[model samples]
Target: MKTKFSFLTLLFIVSSFVIAQDIQELKIDSKVNDVTVFLDGAQVTRKKTVDVPTGITNIVFVNLSPYIDSKSIQVKVKGKVMVQSVSQQRNYMNNQPDLAEAEKLHAEIFELRKQLKLAQTYLTITRKELDFLNDNRIISGRNNELSITNLKETSAFYGERLKALKLKEIKQEDDINQLEKKIQQLENQRNQLSDNRGFPTGEIVIKIESKTNSKSEFELSYLVTNAGWFPSYDIRAKNISEPVEILYKANVHQDTKVDWENVKIRFSSSDPNVSGVMPSLNPYYISYNYRPSNYGRIISEVSGFIYDNKGEPLPGASVSVEGTTIGTVADINGHYSLMLPAGSNRLKISFIGYSSKTVDANQPLINIALNESAQELGEVSFRDVEATSISDALQGRIAGLDISRSRNKKNIADKESIAVPFVQTENQTTVEFEISVPYSLKSDKKTYAVEMVDYSLPANYQYFCIPKVDKDAFLLANITDWSKYNFLEGEANIFFEETYIGKTILDVRNAGDTLQVSLGRDKNVVVQRELLKDKTSRQFIGTKKEVSRAWEINVKNNKSQKISMVILDQVPVSKNEEIEIEIKDLSGAKMNNDTGELKWEFELNPAKEKTFNLNYLVKYPKSRTLYIE
Candidate 1:
């Protein structure tokens, strides 16, 4: 009885093991590869179901993307199943040509080679027979009488057999060539199919335990690399009086070795490559310093380089001061220098194969590049200045306009535009726009623009001029509530009254509530300044000299509409107390005494003319020579 019971127990255990030994395949393909991407990696997930018995079982999930990080794989099972082990591996053989098809090609090639061997064997045998006939001297035999007729009959018999043998050999050669070519063609087709196998498909194996007979759903996730996105923008303003429309957009791209195929997407403005360590703060200190003052005035010396459009130096280029005979030619390195008169602010540069360029000499170092002129001449020039760009052109023009990224998590946009949703999120360290709609992007470097935000803001237009530096007047558009819109610094094309004026950089990073942009210069208002040489005089008293100067300015409004304008000029400021200066006449102009700046603001009617005068006197010691401009 004891032996029978023990045997029965062992038999029961065996039966249970046999029943639980059932292995099921849960083929799960990666369904989501377009998850929010980090700087270092991307997020991906997959799901499937596997039936489990009331015991331990192995579940194999196939067709996973090869780009998945094997080490990052995590498996979760529902329905009272405990995952024992989760692993990932690649199977290139599975993605190769079908085994039966490959075998068929191999068989055909083998058969052809066998046939070729037979043909070669037959050819050797025929050649040997022909050699035997040649050596046997068939024209006559040792013990046989020879006759001309018998010889002819014997020769005819051997010749006919030789011709048949040669024909057979030729046919075999042709057959071999055809067979080889056919085999080669089949092999090439197989090779082409292999090449199109695409990314190596991988599989995930999961060992799980179930307490009772049950079915479980498996959720798998892994991280991948080579995916991210960038932002672009479009800004439009119909008229100077109307509000500006700003359309924010995003350009996303990915090459994770898998097709997303309408998978929902979430974008994050984060870089996973950044360290997650907490930052430490240290104490700060400040100090002050003092120095002696130098009363000497700095001479205005301008230096610059002349380069071609390709950034190569034009050694023989000519650089000259505008309206003056003073000039210099560039050296071998395209460097030149000239002492500028106090009132002169422009320089002209010219090269043989390039168009001449005029640049402001206000800065100490002025670098000018010339563009190659077209061969054709006498083309009509356009009067209206076209805007350089119609949208965001402020890129690289301002500081602190960079959008930051996070290492983990993406904020999804709440607002949807035409079924494409946009999510905006902000922090002290980063700002992000999360798009929920699926965006298709390939590994190719082509750019795709997606609209993110649209904004309309009020703006005011004004005409301003600084005649002391530039003679032309510029149109300025002042916008308040600029801070309300989260704008990045970029290039903007300006248009006024339905006409494109020019392009200007829109830098809202440093602007607080109000932002001002300069449209191109206006030509309707004309301004001129003339020196009154007849009223100028100089005299010497003892060892001191007194110099007196006078100037007149004329401004005219040529437009049909009345306009207000601001005119700016300046009198020389003295760094030395020994130099005595006095303002004699200002013609009721506003003066900033500390800066010696003069300003005039007034409205002029259509086709109206206005005049103003400025007079000043400078007295200094005659013993020391003075430079006046």
Candidate 2:
């Protein structure tokens, strides 16, 4: 504020501006520490050259802060050189705003203190009056009537006191509101005053100044278009970046004056070199190259299906691929095109809010149908069960043999329902099934038409189900019908493929241990006394010579325990002739070919009894070569 030219000096300056080109007045007001130039009010930029007339023009100045907008400032000066040489300093005391808010709050608190004083006085008087009534001194008129009069007086005092308290509270609230408004005003002021000081963002303001002979005119065509974005917001990891494309679905017009109909106009992103529009129908694919910078062209595609766990298709269910930029609403048929990648090698499919699933899509087609996971029931298969018996109790488990029959109620019926009969081996392993009548309809003494569809099955299992009837046709018809298998109750023995857990197995002899045994093509082996559901599953592809079918233990206390053992066997018939076992252990064991079992007892002081394992080779014709894949 030190430098100033008198009004008389300004008259001299006016005379000095003899030509219109002379700048008669020059002034500057700045909110930043230094200001050597001026920019457009909204632009916040410095122009290369600003034509000035021979006079003092009221050029407004502004402050700069990151959080504030520019505000106008006023100053007075007298010469071009003075204006050019002058650097105005600008400052804003941000802390002073809190001072304003504090002042308002202080005033509000003062008013509140006055109201609180009045309220306190009222409350004191009310309490004193209530105490007087409690002493019954305020009684009058009749007994009850006097009591009512005292209550009336007490209530009136209390009501007045409460109202006064409420009024004081309301005043406090008003004070808080005033403080809030003051704080808000301070914020607004700060925001209104901030600017970048001097920096350039990508926002461009093109003020078109046209000269029709000396008549200079200007117009603005503001464009806030993105300079770095490729416009395509859809990109999947599997998609390679090309010139990413975006479709402006909204209707676009040229200008306010005219409406263009069906104009096939194109819009460019940052660079005019890259541009695209919606493709016309039936055009050959044109190759578009992408210019790579820090950002890559984002692109995408999506495939999947929705289904319920019951093998039923869920219609119109939403399915999505996680982490994939591509998405599609499921079709009316409940199928979705998750054309995200060529395929998500690790395909994760999900419905709305349901648990998502990840499955490997290693097939030619990667469309996966999702099913809700289910909890299985507690039950098992009986054929997979070792028949309960004393012999069953002592059997270490059997390898394989012809048969030693056990007691079972075999019933004859009008129609013979065929089934495979199962028996346990010495190890308590439910192994073999003698298929005397591979398929037969039979009724038990109780008239129960029961039939075991499988001739053999696994030993250790957690759950099992079987068709009531053994007819293959009926079984196939009811495969998914839910009524085929009457699931037997009880934890299964052969519970897992190679290991069993979370399930109980009555492995009287640790038969619950997963038996991963490989059977030779024509070897007769007793697998399990009762099978899981399919005894054929107990069979395996042998990469090594099969375990010897027969094992023997010397009954000398170390080896023998004449434990009552029931053995089951299986013989792959290469010849039409019957297969028999040649035993060398204890003589008490009996063999029954019809049932494919061997059972007996031998005495052992841990000595006289001996245990043995048996194996046999099946002979076939030279021309009868079996081919297996």
Candidate 3:
């Protein structure tokens, strides 16, 4: 019985050893480096497949990047397999087999050292023999020579011996020098390896249990520091009559030491590196009657309801005192309460798909309205451009746009609610873009333009010329319900009538529901501004000075098409209370007295011209000299 037990124990030990040795290493491939990097952090996923035996298995991935966040390591298995445990540890001892080349170099160094020592020993021996021959010179040390023949023979023999010893020493020294040079090269290689590794190798160890013996594929994903991506876009418009094209792109950068090759990539707008859980909110009771010793330090609580422009209740609206963390969300009835410090009367309210609103909190029943965000853009489409550069496209395209599967799905609930069964919805907090084409990104930091979404929408075109500042007419496209398009503040490239006009900025930060994009200057509409010196004069009346000026503007439509146009000019404004100003002549133009702005809107037929005049008078004390135009 004892012998049988020993045999069984031996078998079990062998099996365990075999199981531990059954490790499979996978190579990272199909990497999407165009990551959707949030304000902070990046994520990378790698997919690999390996055939595993039907039982317990230990998989060891070696030589991974050291910058990997161990806590972010995740292992997913496909097929009938169960993951047991996943762990990551640093290998300071440099156990990676791939470094065998470095080890081989070190071995060569060792051999070279041995050879160098041998050569050195030989060199020393040759030097010693040369020294002995020189010290024991027959002609200098001893006086035993009698005849000239004997002296010459003895001298020749010693001379030959000295020459041979010198040659031998030279050969040994040359060999030693060559060996030392080779050793130096090996040491340099080792130093480079240390620099590349930074410290030691990082290895990820995964243990899995298989229910049945079948081939399975595994995907290993982890978050790595020093790798992230940012959002970039390209907007192009062929003409004001056509819809604008916006290409959403990502600029990804990484120095994690791992190359993510042509793999499936997903960009996340939300940062995984940030805290996922909301901060704990402790209970607080409002005490209106209690004030701190200093009245200035008194605090207060304000509650209010949030509504939309149509007077509809807005649930989930976030209300907080401006610049303070104290806040709350509106309930189903759009009612919210917030505790604020004294003198903080400012309140800020925000909701998804709506413009944020800020108002004073002086009224307890503060009712506010939040305008809806930009309207959803049209389907992605493309247009041709004479300029082929990405930078040129971004500079020329229309600034806002999107079309996605999420937008196509009807009855899609708010991203905050629970998802319906058998339905897949995108996360509201993050934006996902799947490029239709295959793209590659490098570890080096650089921006590559990828086509994201194209949009087609109706545009209302109008010609506007500010003759006061510029003589050229600029085409403007007024797009209503612009809030429906999910446009962020970015640059736009403008093209008019298949021509590359110029570039402008699409600033949605403070835009209203209507978006006005300016196309480049149009020289076809000629404008001329001339000062009428004959109609200008200055006079002094009873210690007071009166200055008068007059100007004329002429606009000519030189294009074949009849166009509606607006001409803008300004009158001088005075700040001194003692000065009196008057608009002597406006030619029926609309004038803003507060701003001293004059605007004329009219339709001009082809090959037709219109003229307008502006005259202003300024009166000030004659005692004080003043410059007026």
Candidate 4:
């Protein structure tokens, strides 16, 4: 019985060894098939096909983004294969393709450095010769006697040599400076290219079991954090009678180190990085207030350039409001402008190879210079645990969740006229726009403009002027039913009458039923405000002082067409009980008593003008002085 048990144990051991050896490991490269970019992140899908052996096999997909979210990984296999497990890991052994331009720049910089060293050597030699000549001249003059003619000849020779050496020294110095400048420029270019490189590439390994030798296709997808898109718009109006043309665009950017070449791309309004958990309301309790400090000055928008310590522009640098996700990437010229959220006081600026900086956001223009990091970034590690097994019956259903394929296609009679061919998909929490054509995007962090769609909506054009603040009249376009357009708050470039006006912020988040877009200032529709000296008076009663003031505003429609205009004026609202204000005349204007704002709407024809007068009186105690204008 002992001998039989030993034989069974030996057989079992041999069987286990063979089974372990049967699992073959295969390394394959997968192509990026589709990418769905969100506002804060992106979902990348890769697909590959390989012949499966009639046993357990492990397929490893290589050259993926290092910033991938391991928990969001999903793998699906199609064929007679059962996916047993999936895992992600960082492969430090793999070498990514170097940037060709960057490599060229490196070589060029090396040559320039050699030239600079040679020039510096020449300058050093020239200076040494000058010093030696000076020493020899002093020694000869003091230690030896010579004729006048000889002395004159010796002095001439010495002076000529000194001048020649000095000129040579200056020339060499200039050459060295020029070479150093060239090297610096090349180094800057190379640094920009190698910003996010020198890191390990990511890999996804799937262990599957197959019943027979067959061919199978695999789809692997994961969420990456260093990719996103932002919206921008162009508002164009030809005239007051024509409909406004709104062109929507997306600025897509990525630094994932994986180039998306001719892949299907989609833009989603959802932000996967933000927590999706439903927020619960806590109990509201009233509390007594103590001292309330005045809030600092609120900044509406901030714009500036990002630079390195060497004063070179750092394109693709990130600029964001501290403690908030509101951010933007610097453009090719290193210029970035972001609208500040309410109560945002600080801005955080960062780049790949530079130390991040935080600056106060109180100023409209905040430029930051970042220093190079002294230490290398830590290695990114990923979890290697088994992924949730996807059943063969639900593989197709699960794949559909990442991207919702549209079945209904819109018929386009004139495809050539479409700026961008795309289909819009509405999801539960977000809207997606799938581009019909394939797009190729590089792994660089620079933003690429992707034109999405355009809409022509009927707009009511009105000229608005607050002469008390600004003398120029701004043209406003009010578009109703704007919610259907899926517009986000972003900067818009305004064009009126086929001329580029200026940029304005499209604050869709704070809009009502009608979206009012400012088309910048129109100098043709002029406005001016002046004080009426005749109606201004001051008097003093027994213990009270009273002052009366009047102002007149004129609006002119200098354009050839008639236009509607809205004029705004304001009266001072008294905050103290001892101070009293009364409106004497408003010239048929609607007044808001609480805010002390007056509004007048009227129509003016070509070369026509309209005038409105505002008169008010203020009464205050004689002991206190109140300034009014």
Candidate 5:
């Protein structure tokens, strides 16, 4: 019986040892192979190949971004292995790598502090020595009688010693001041660098079960924050006779704390952060509206970007309405929006190291640049204000503004040489551009411009002018079938006739079948509007008033070729039944009765000019005052 018990014990021990050996923990390194960057976040795909033994195993992937969403974790294993479960956890032990420049600056600041301390100590000691010399300066007359030569020598020694100590004290103080300034500069630099570092990493652990020992390939993917892309464009037109060439590009940025080296990039217009489920409509209940009323009309909101003199975004800048408490701060992207009270027409902008500026708030979009200030101000604290949503701020708020994406085109003659580096794919609700070449994107917050594609489309160009509003003529290009090119609303750099003109916004979201793009002001086309003083008159007839006004507008085409031009002018419409307005002469112009706007279209040859006349008469009660311009 004793021998049988010993054999069973030995068998049990061997089986337990084999089971423990089969289940092993393996740490594997993975490389970021592909990245799909969205408008708000990015999806990272990593791959690795490894050999595994039979049985259960835990594969650990380390050094990932701590901002990764755990629920988005996905693991796939190819070969004879079956993925049992995948999990992720924060790895505080493995922090992000320290920035080399920041570390060097820190060392330099430490050394400078030590030198400043020494200089301060030396200055204090020198001052003490000067005091000691002054206290003993009376020794010559008080203690004993001395020869004239001895008295002169002692006086000279004291004068020379005091002067030397004073100079030394001045030198030490200067040195200390310089060291402090140097330390401050270095600290600022270090602070900027340190902002991008010290984030803890993450680790993903996958449990796998394999039937037989074999080589396995694994793919892991997850969504990470602090990464996104925005679109920008370049619109070029060599001349009015040719088509407009549009260059589409994207500004990609990421701060995932992991460098994406030689990885394939795909820009997706879809925002995975937004919910995919369709919204359901609830039953509506009717109710009476009761609200307080203000006297003047109030602008709902105003939104725009705040930039520094160098065109860089000034985040955390303060923007407030003049003479009111309504205000908000810029976001991390330098975007701000404020709700204006009644009759607020000016905006006050301020920053710590930049000069404050006050600008007119008459427009919906107000972008301002603040210059750097010589004197630094104390830190300003901002309240945590909830920003208005993009949809809420844009819907029916900004007239004629739309959002979409677009592609660019090179010159028509160089169409063969133009190589598109991306393939466009359309999904149900979004579009994606898959880049062909691999990209190496570092873990920095700076933007990388990625050129997508170029396009040259047929356009109808015409010159448009509103002489009453602006004397300069603006060139407009009407592009038919613009919807085929997926376009997003963004800032566009405009170039006409081989010269860089300026910048404009390309908004196609609210466009119809035809898209009209402004090519900026053309100085060659001169326009002048004059009011005829002899035709202006006002008279009263027994509590009734009659006013007559006449204006003349002249347009001259100075270009070497014939051009099409459209001129626009407006007349005031009566708001009260007691007032009446009549147009005597519009110079054969088309008029909109509802808006009282006149439009004239014509073609002019080089060095040719055209003139138009507008005459109007207004009749109103003489008791009420009326203003017209």
Candidate 6:
């Protein structure tokens, strides 16, 4: 029950990508038994409570059943809690503090431990530097101990430089108590700016049988924090086999004596009659926030990332982005990396306002903050990016996005139907998607032609569907009951780069007589053109982005063979960096310049739309004009 490891700097202000016309699976998490779930797997309610009412959005954190077993039912996400705790001023161990000065010393020692004489000298100097940083960083061996491997990289670089100079002397003693709270906010803005009307929010009617307040039933729910008082409720235990024992009783105003720890559980604060006992009430609010407990004041902010109207990436939002900076952190889920002025361009996101966004500097990703502004009077929670999500319904009617499992299969969606590129050799070329049938469901070489047995596919990875090829069986079993078949419309011209990584399909069953199909809604989508076109706009050709070579495509009958496409392109190595590729198409008809491979015969003519002819090279740095979507 130690659980006192904080460096609090969490800000999170990225929410604006919510399009789930249907088919969900977007993964999200926040455990330790507390709760922050968001799976994108499908159907979910219990958002607990979320409301900022206004500006900024760009959320994402999907893991929904990555085909299960990503480590036993693994779908972990929620990565942008920014600055959790980082305090120290044993003299700012030489100043360098960050993590919002460790979440402003975990929100100032949990609000000066209820004013224990303004924090009994800050819990006696964080219990004497948590007992000499837990005895030289957790019992000798400091920095989480363990060494001996030719000086384990010089004892883990001087044990992480003595835990980063003892967390920059606990963030220079919380930036000298935030420069004494910026000198008491410049002496309250030079005295007399009285707006002390503060108290506004209020709502408390939860009774869950009073959580055993003389009755029974020990389940609960009631949340809201900071700006209000009365320990926030957080009793979490979502169906854990069994084991739900809670018996907290509070009453410690007879004169202080508290102490409570976390991580599993522990309590101690006796006083029920001075002779001892009365300080273990940790009712549960766990935002811990260890604010710049000691050192704080780093600087930098221009923030970005906020989308959700089907653009995704909005984990937590409550930003400022104005004049420069004020507060915020969460973004991994909503995508943000702000520190400002590394090149500073522009940013704004405003909350409690309902209509205040501004973003710039070439879209660092704000996916969809198109709200317009209106509804935001007050309490009515749960709007965690309700614009529309599910990865924005396969972005533009499924041009390509395979990572399925979301028909309520419980999350792991985003870019569903996509299977057309696996072309193994014979000079690789592509233009796939085949399944036409309709001659009375064809099947009969007269003499009762029957014999389609061939199994072995527990799970080889590639599982999207529509592989009914059998121009007399090139390896697909012939046709038994692998789901009747049908799914071939117009395989986009050629633009395959669904992020390959060892890809595995295994030539349609056994390649001797194939017949296996999966996806059917008559899909084929198609829409992709410039795979490098002529080259212009400042043309340096590329500073990087021309690697390409990972091809695969199939279609036994409507034919269009030879595949090795990776074409992708991008340049600019610095000045905001850029580098992406997998190219090699020599000249549409054939050539494998070592491995950027590309061979063709191209034909799959089901609906229409086709074009092929490739070349590669890009390294620009000077002239600019990049407009992408």
Winner by lDDT: 4
Using TM-score as the measure, the top candidate is 4
Q: Write the per-residue lDDT of candidate 3 for residues 1-629, one digit (tens) a residue.
A: 99999999999999989867665444323333333333234565555677766667777666665666666565666767767677676667663334777888889999999999999998988898888888878564455545888788888999899889888888888899899999998997886675455445556666766666688776665656545444434455665446765554444444555555544444444456446677896765668897543334233556778888989777656565554323456777888766555446687776644777788676667788899764222112111222132222112323222344223221211221111111111343444444333334454322233334455657776799887788889887777886654554444556666677655656555568778777768888899988999989999999789999999999998887787788888887778898989888988899887898888999898899999998988889988988775
Per-model TM values vs. the true structure: 0.47, 0.18, 0.49, 0.79, 0.69, 0.19
For residues 53-116, write the lDDT of model 5, one tens digit per residue. Answer: 8889989888887767766666666688777677776675665446576678878999999998
Q: lDDT scores for all predictions?
A: 0.63, 0.29, 0.63, 0.79, 0.76, 0.27
Per-residue alpha-carbon lDDT of candidate 2 for residues 136-233, written as tens digits (9 for 90 to 100): 64435455554667788877876786576566656655665665566556554544333111111111111111122122111111111100111111
Kindly list the per-residue Cα lDDT of model 4 for residues 332-365, writing each as its tens digit: 7789998775556687776755787889887888
Candidate 6 on 418-457: residue-level lDDT in tens?
Answer: 1111111110111111111101111100101111111222
Please state the error at residue 431 of candidate 3 in Å: 3.1
| Cα error, candidate 3, residue 80 (Å) | 13
RMSD of each: 23.1, 34.8, 21.6, 6.8, 12.2, 30.1
Off by over 4 Å in 6: 1-33, 37-202, 206-214, 222-629
lDDT of model number 4: 0.79
Candidate 1 lDDT, 204-315, residue by residue in tens: 7776767898777666666665454443344555644567665555544455546565555554445553466988977545556744444332446678788887887776
Residue 510 lDDT (model 6) = 29
lDDT of 6: 0.27
lDDT of 3: 0.63
Error (Å) of candidate 6 at residue 87 is 39
Where model 4 places Cα greater than 4 Å from the true spot, the runs are 1-19, 96-118, 124-167, 181-197, 278-297, 305-313, 320-327, 341-360, 367-418, 575-577
- Which of the two candidates, 4 or 6, achieves a greater TM-score against the reference? 4
Worst 10 residues of 5 by lDDT: 376-385
Give the range where candidate 2 is weakest over 10 consecutive residues by summed lDDT.
Answer: 470-479
